[model samples]
Target chain A: MDIINNLVKNLGDGIAAGIYGALGQGLAADILIMVIAAIAVFAVASGGFAGLTYAERKIVARIQDRVGPNQAGPYGILQPIADAVKLFTKEDTTPAEADFWVYNLAPIIVAVFATLTFTVVPFAPGVVGTNLNIGAFYIIAIGSASTIAILMAGWGSNNKYSLLGAFRTVAQLVGYEVPMLLNMLPVIMLTGSMSLVDIIERQAGWNGSWGLPFIVILPLSGLAFLISGIAEAGRSPFDLLEAESEIVAGFHVEYSGMKFGLIMMGEYMNALGVAVMFSVLFLGGYAGPILPPYLWLVLKAFGVFLVLMWLRGTLPRVRIDQLLNMNWKFFVPLSVVNLILVMILGKVFVSDPALFKANGGILIQPLAQALIMGASSFVLLMIALAIVTRRVRKDRMAEARILLQRRETNQQIAASVH
Target chain B: MRTDYAFIGVTLVVACALIGVVPILNYLIAPQTPNKSKRETYECGMETVGDTWVQFRAQYYLFALIFVLFDVGGVLLFPFAVAYNSVNLWGVIVVSLFVLTLLASLGYAIKKGALNWE
Candidate 1:
């Protein structure tokens, strides 16, 4: 019974111990364990990608009031497998004038970088593939590098639409990346660590209960991060990079067969990475009651993924101009202000050792501090919302005036003609 | 720290191998029915016009510039953020001033209409 209960908790350590025992604690054993861990993370990420695709299709289908993929296997559960087989067997095509090497290499780069992000993520206590000190920063760096791959796909395709898509990718991805980086600061400030595991550990309450998630404290940063994350993953309404109507499949327009599949896989993997990162950073990763820790992490990640799909199903893609404007004019400024606010709040409430110790230990002190921070962030959000609302209303009035003027001129022309 | 990074290095190599192998497998299994039209650049069923290396608008450069500034700034702030608890009031003040400078730059960019998509 204890083994079953502790099985998921100590699974990683157990595997490592078993390998060491078998191999007599040599360097070979360490290397073997690392390789095994890598493969395991790769497998989980790939499996999550496949499941995400199926879930997205089903959820979007239901949103559209249609039955989706009932034929593949038991409610189209095996649809991703069928899709994979079909893609693998399809004709691979490359344009004659395309940059042959880079065209072929971009998707591989995408797939590799997308999968690499899974390394620092903590699935359970003591179950990370690698607990890098700079895990959070490492993720951002990897995400930015993947942008270069998309640019390669676009430039190498030798297609106008692909080039256009690549341009939009730079504008959208880079613009949103600022706010995304900025939003992460508040969490880091409160937790005083950049490692995801440390952040998670910081959220544990006294007596091992669930402590206050950062989202409760820094709602503004959480909201900002989620929006920017959606854009970074290229989901709607921020998916201007590959808006099919405008750019015709964006950066990977020239890819065919499994190369295209690889890019698609990379994208879903990225979405999963973002979802998992959000859960780890803000949702008190792997910390919940009455369930395996890893299972809790997975559940939170899926919840985030479903929310992404819901947004995809409902929101229309924003125009490129609207997208960039929203990022620069709104999110960037908001995130900057949110970060400063959080820094000041942290200094005021959490800096004093005496005050921190006096309050009911780890859980209660942070909770009190977070309550104040949360209220301030809520007020900041409202102020920002009011400003945006006023700006939008003013723009609409000017637009209405122009339309009315145009209509009157047409009416006057009609009267003169009559 | 070294061992942890070794895990990452191993995972990276494995991930590369896994992703690299798939395309090779596709090449082996997938059909090769190459033809003139099939290999042509897709332009919505029309002949390809100008070169794909058309000059893009300069507006994208401005966003790139802003991104670089903010990205570097954010990275600089990370260490400060992580060490926020142990730092004295002066540290917090210095970081606030740094953030204020960033915000000032953003404001200048907005005023100059660098963010305008047009």
Candidate 2:
């Protein structure tokens, strides 16, 4: 047990030294590996886009009790490839009235930002493309680039629907992002690190393990993060960005052929990015028993993505007003309250001497903290439920009173006629 | 750690190149026989109408403006949260005050109906 654990722990250092030795101890080899890894991340993310569409169609079809995309290959596994071919062969259409430069530049910007997020995702120890100190924050910053890209597409397309779609997209993103960022605080507070790899590592080991994932401890924050994340991805029930019935595909309405394909690719890539981040931040990244770390991360991300797809299939799209209302009135307030609750709980019960390292660093006592936060969150949830129920009952009473008054008025009029 | 950014730079270039190259490749191999009709801006097959550019709602701008304030505040809180384990109770109290100020702004925004969609 000791030998295997030591080997597993030193895996990253071993790989680094091995590469250094093989490359004759120079910076060139590191750069070469970095470049290769960067390209690989791009390739994987793009491929993830293809896989996601297939998965989405299949899942939604099963939900609707129908077979989907079964023509192209066995069970439609090759449908994405078929899609790529069709998109490639279709005529690239550019509107005569469109702004030439901005129209041409928007798709590229979207694709680039979508791909940029992959740099910070750690699939396993020694497996990340680059582990920046501000990995979590960096993801958020990179995400903002998509907003600019959407605006460019909307304005450049020279279409009313596209412009309106862009406007809604901006509102949805801005509304949800505050709560999303706030929801992340508990994770950061508990872990005391911003680098994703470090966060994962802090959740490592038997005694110090935070129950294998932060989500287990902070369920309320986890729920808030998931919902906000879905909004951020522009997925249903918050997919007002491309609400086809209202705006005819939103910001990308003007794009066709390969350009349209690029826009779709960016969207799917963003979804995959969110899934990966959620896995890393809450599900303990790549930590698991028995299975390889990278595989574990992949499985967890896939599981999260599946849940997202399930929500997409089951829920109807919300109107733009309702969408904004949900975010501002419900999610934002809940997230903030959750953050304060977490902070208080951490301060009161989580600052024990045993939880601190001899070197003044803190080790999360997962069991203790989980016991505290879980109970607090449940109490918080119950309070929210109670408030909602009370408001509902009050509304029902007012409605009943109005109905009774109308009935009495009708009875008096009948009596007067008799 | 700083040098790791070079990887990101390379990744950006590669991403741009991939997006740029694929469409150009499609243009190269795909038959492009565009007539005046094909080149026209696609509406649901109606004749070209007035200018395509139209005014949009300012409600989006309101949310974005508020987003700017909150996002910056969130960024400021990042350091505090990252160092929370080591920070003393006084430090926690001070940061809590900072967060409370942010919450106060949010409450003000709510009271002003800044979040009202209609």
Candidate 3:
């Protein structure tokens, strides 16, 4: 295990060296290295889908107290391979009225966009692809393409269900994106950098070597981000795009053979990409004790993914109206407020030169600031809960009163008639 | 930066090729026996009705427009947020007022029931 860990840690350097040797060092080497990195990222994104499928099945099975996919080679680890082979061998079909160009292009767009997000995710200290200046917004910009891709699939399929599914997807994904972007505002404010690597570095320890992750400082922001991001990634509870019971496989209903496999690959890759982003933004990417950097990142991302599978197993899918309402009415408002609160609180307390310098850069004040933010957020949540419950109770009481009054009036009329 | 674009361009082209190649591989392996009924648009074993391109509700357009408004506004916020620490207090105030406007618009939208489902 230790040897494997060491080997994994050195893999990036080994690949870089190999590229340099092949291309000769300098500008040419840099470009060639990037090409190699891109291919590696693509492979990881596509292959990660198979691993995610296995992980999701096993985790959900464990949640339900049942074994899953154990028949196909050692606890079904090879199940995805078998599934892939089956898909490859299955008959490919196109609907008579389908728009062939758009139909063919949609899955390609989805897959490419999904892989593109991997460019910005920092697995370790030096293991990032490009770390572009606009790293944060780049993810959002690239992610929006999935909406277009799904629209293409739906419209091009010439299936009513697919079109309806595509519309729902656009509505849901777009709605959730607002809150997701808003939720990241606080993280950016605190870190003072849009780069993922910078965010992680800023989150490193104030006094001691151990860091306080962004989630510790702004739990409300983290919570909001994760919820909306899950919806953005089209996971369960927001899996309206492929709501099997309702839409008959949804936007990709007409897709078959390897095309269908490509769509599924896109789905899982998007989820994995989001999970990596979650870790980078909130959990302090590549910052942990004892473990290798990439290993820490993988473990943290896997932890997030496990939570996603747990959510899939425990929660039922929400109605489309309910999904939109949650995004717009609840999450959007809450995220806005949370962002404002963090910006204000962070500016006044945590970033103040007087308090921070007076304390000689001790970690105590940062911890105190985090506690204050957490306490205030909790108070706000409780107050909101109280107001909502009171409103619901009043509505229910009024409804009951109306029912009773109607019954009395009916009884009086009956007596008078008699 | 130019190199970064090169990387992205290569990745995209390769990814597209990979997606295309998979289906071609399947085409080579899989049998093709297309029939008239098999080629018809799928409607859960039912015959074709009217055209499948039905117009969606206007609400979707409303959401998309709202999303565009907020998303573009949010993109503008990222620059200010990243430069927050180095900037002066007036810079903070300016951005705060900007965010306040966004919040006010959202609140107005909610009060007008733009987000209501019913």
Candidate 4:
């Protein structure tokens, strides 16, 4: 019984130790363990991608009042496998004038970077592929690098639509990234550490119960992060990068077969990455009772992904200008202010030792602090919403006035001519 | 820390190898019969007109510049955030001032119509 529980709890560590013991604890054993862990992460991410696609299709189909794929092996369970076989067998195409090397290298870059991000994501306690001190920063850096691969695909394609899509990529991805990074600051501040494991541990209440997640204290930043995360993943309403109606499949316009398959894999992998990160950052990570830690983490991540799919089904894609405007004009400013507010609140309520003593209990301190911060942030959100509503109303009224003036002038000109 | 990074490096190599091998295998298995019409750039069945690498608007460069500015600022602020608990009120003041400076730059950019889509 003891061995079984230990095996269930420390599965990854047990495997590493088993390999080490088998290989006499040498450097080769270390290298082999790392390689195996990497492969495991890749498997998990790709499997998540496959399942995400099927879930997205079914959810979106139901949203549109239709039955989704049901033919392939019991309610379309094998649909992704069938799709994979078809993509593998299809003929790959490269445009005659395309840059041969960069065009071919782009998909590999996308897949590699997407897979690399899973390195720092802690699945369960001590189950991370790596425990980098700058885990959060590493994720941001790797994510930004994928932008280069996208640009390479677009420019190397040598097609007009691809170039347009590439330009939109710069405008949208770079624009929303500012807000995303800014919003992350508050969570880092509250935790006082950049290691994702530390951040998760910081959220635990007394006795390791599921404590108040960061979302409760910093709702504004959490909301901003979600919006920016969706944009970062290039999903709907912010998917100006590959708005199919506008740019005919965007950056990968010229890619065919497995190359296109690789790009799609990168995209779905990114969506899964974002969902997992959101869970780790704001959903108390793998912290739950009764169920195993990794299972809790997976459940939370799937919940977030379901929300993403819901939005993808429900929302219409915004125009490029509107997308950029929302990022810069709305989210960026809101996040910056929220960061400052959170900084002050953290210093006063969270970081102060006196407050902890005064509160007289571990749970009370966090609860009180959360209440204060949450209330303040809710007020800030209300004010910002009111201001935005006023500005939008004013703009609409002014545009209506201009149209009325134009119509009246046309009527006057017609009367004069008569 | 070093061992962790070594693991990351190995994972990176493995990820590259895993992704790279698929296309190679596909190349071996998948048929490749290229024709002139098939290899041409797709333009919705219309003849290609004008160069694809035409001059893009300068607005893209402007956005990139602003992004770089904020991105660097965020990187600089990260250390302060991590050290926030250990630092004093003076530290808070200094960080606040730094943020104020960033906000000032954003205001200047807004005033100059740098963010205007038109």
Candidate 5:
């Protein structure tokens, strides 16, 4: 390695090498490396999502113990590529009765949001496409555009199924985004930055774990994030929007070829971004040893993606009414309680930064804090369950008593009339 | 930001490249025969008539209305978290009250059964 470096150093022109003063040269090299990292991340993310669409189907199939897409290529390795080719070559047809402009643009919105999300995601320390200081905000803003895009596709498609699917999407998304945003609040509270890179960096360091787990510090909030993030990715038991057989593929009912492919790919991209975001927030993004940080990050994100698949495959799609009920009734209350706990946590800890500092290498003050958080969560969940369960049982008992009394009254009336 | 336009360019290029490969690939594997009727819009074994575009429910507007409030409320908390350490009691109260207001609205929606679909 030393010989190769010296040999390469000697081969460069004298003026170019001299202008590359140690400090200046390092700066220029860093910029070039940043550019390259950005490019590579974008390519891999796009291709990776395309590949993941295939993987999603395959994994879901295997869970059901079935062979999926076997005839395409070896182990279905070429399946995504083949699928892409087929979609592209197939005729781009529009319904004669459809709104052509919005129809064309609608498909683009779904694909575009999918691609644009790569800009804010960080694969490793310096590998992010662009570290917008408002990275989290950017994701929410750009990500929600797909809802409008989906709406456009559905409306423009001129199919009843498509319109119904589009409306379902608008409802499910609007419902789920409530809790999704509420859940994400605590992580930003702990990290104190919205940049994806900053959040990950705060959780990780050059040599070792941060010792403090985001999951530990903000437990219920983290779980809420998981629940809402699952919904955000449109997986079950929150996938009523795209409930196949019932909705006939929903709003994309009329779309075919590349247009359909774009919407499908968009779903996977949202999943990818969300899985990574979930990891960064709760799982200590890239906080591991023995493996390069980027690899660790992918492993963490992949783990989340698999959990999503497991959810979609195992749980039945929740009823639309129950889905909205859970959001408004359950998720809303828990998130509120969690937010209060987060605020209290912020006041107790952040008010005194000294507690977090290294004092003779002994972790200070946070152990009790973590225990209090745990006990608080256990209490809240139990109380919520107790309240909800009691109310439900009470209602059922009341109904049963009513039926019994009515039966007795009817029998008495029959005897009197006779 | 430069990556944005570069990606658009790449996708266009990829689309073109894939288009070029299809015919050769098709010759090697499958036959390319076009039946005129295949391109027609399918409508449950019936000859399609009239415009496909139709109006849908306006009720999603209610969902959208609730969405704006909560989604905006979610965004509102981001900046608050950044400056949380420096926030005073009044600041906390302000945000708390804001959250409380949203909670009330949600309760009203629930009681009125606006969230129910069936």
Candidate 6:
């Protein structure tokens, strides 16, 4: 029934036929396809989002070598559902003095933006809301509304902690956007197309002939992106906004029940959305051929998701001041430098148009440059890592020595007293 | 993903319906028993009229300002970065010069303490 309806809808008027049938369908066809796509994406987004929450907890537990919430339903699979139920059944507390309009508006605005990412974002081959020419722009534009929503949450609640948290989140996300976009420059530059499909289609190979995957070849860009990306998601090492130990649930401190759950789920959904986008950009979205493209898409998205989880499990939250310093003093300049470097390298490297067209969007010149870039960046990165390692080790040893000295002095004093 | 208005229209409709459903659900599910205490603001059970909206530090503004600057910089350069494959001497120069302007603005902002936190 669905397939036949979809087929019938696939034929229609000018926009419906021409625009909608980019997948070769009509107006009605576009609508049917869109409905199916929405249902599929919404389901996947929700289920994946739920699973992600469970996964993060389990990963954190594993890294700490402790059993996580495994009792709920076979390795805590049902824990997210249980949590959702709990939140829904819990008290719905609205502050007496709160601004009713903005308070109500905040979560609605957030959830809408969170789901908006799905429209331009293709989950599989020819399956999306609207493959606008301005797909990338649409994602960014829709994403900006989230900042406004956070601002609304803070102001509506009339709480200092909420306001501060909202401010911090806004700041962090805004700060991270630059480096994140900068990181994408090399990929977009390589693809020579703004469309996400074009980006992924460029990375269609299992083994990079010239270097590792464009993603790995551009490790600095990826690392910078991931660092800021994690910040953008408000996860560990950059989760100063929530800082549960300090701010006590941050901007939604006064929120409870379904409103809070909606907000929380909305955030997780955004994280999942970003993970998918990152995979499409850097890891070749839905590209593996043996399995279906959607399977490959999920796999790549999960792979990116794991990176975020891994970082969360391993790294400590940075101080607020340190976070600011890192963004402004380090990441800002670094991203600019990276953007410039990629631009220069693009000219120096990808000079062959025939080769670029022959090899589907990527130039052999960029591939070669990527090889050299990877090797050199790896070496420089290793040195930096070593320096950081040495400094940390020295600090640990110094602390140990001080502790020993204190113990020995205490022992001597006891012996003298005896 | 074809860009069509009708398809977008359907999507917007569904989203709107979902948005509308929430408020209806809230009214239905919420236990509304009229009571003066329930409606009163509770901060240690005191009287309701007070300022809960305290102004925050200005450091956050600096962070936001810097963020917008950098994000705009990224947005401006993405096109140029992607178009750099043509191996045109002039194209490369234009990008460098464009990026330089952004960097110069950033540097000036830093110098002026626009990025500084109190």
For all candidates in order, the CA lDDT equals: 0.87, 0.82, 0.83, 0.85, 0.70, 0.69
Q: Model 1, range B1-118, lDDT digits (tens) per residue?
A: 6887898789889999999999899999998989999999998999998788878899889889988899899889889888777775567778889888988998899999988877
The true-versus-predicted C-alpha distance at residue A412 of model 4, in Å, is 12
**Tens digits of per-residue lDDT for model 1, A315-392:** 887778788888888998888888878876766666345646543223345557778889999999999999999998
Q: Output DockQ, candidate 1.
A: 0.70
Interface RMSD of 6: 3.6
The number of the candidate with the highest lDDT is 1
With candidate 5 superimposed using the best TM-score fit, by how many Å does residue A392's alpha carbon deviate from the native? 6.3
Tens digit per residue, CA lDDT, model 3, A177-217: 99889888888887777888898887776325658888877
Candidate 3 has a TM-score of: 0.90
Name the TM-score of candidate 5.
0.79
Better of 1 and 6 by DockQ: 1
lDDT of 5 by residue, A119-206 (tens): 6676655545566777777777777888898889888877666777788888887777777778777777666788877777765631
Residue A47 in candidate 5, Cα distance off native in Å: 2.2
How do the residues A1-418 of candidate 6 rate in per-residue lDDT, one tens digit apiece?
4443233224323334455546655556656756655555456666777888899889878988889998898888899989876765565677777899998778877776677677666656666556665556566666677878888987788766677788888877777777777777777776777777666656774234321355666777767776776777777778887778876667787777677776876788778878887777766776664666667778888888888888778888887766776677667676676666666655555536674553333456445666766665566456655765686689679989999999999999999999
Which of the two, 1 or 6, has more lDDT?
1
Please report how far candidate 4 places residue A93 from its true position, in Å: 0.9
Candidate 4 lDDT by residue in tens digits, A127-204: 788899999899899888789999999999999999889899988888888988998888898888999999889886
DockQ of 5: 0.26
Q: Candidates' DockQ values?
A: 0.70, 0.61, 0.60, 0.65, 0.26, 0.38
Interface RMSD of 1: 2.3
Q: Which clashing pairs does model 4 show?
A: none
In model 5 chain A, which range of ten residues has the least summed lDDT? A355-364
Least lDDT summed over 10 consecutive residues: which range in candidate 3 chain A?
A355-364
Q: Summarize candidate 2's per-residue lDDT along A38-140 as a digit string, tens digits.
A: 7789988987898889989999899978898999989999999999999999888887778999998898898899999999998877778788988888988
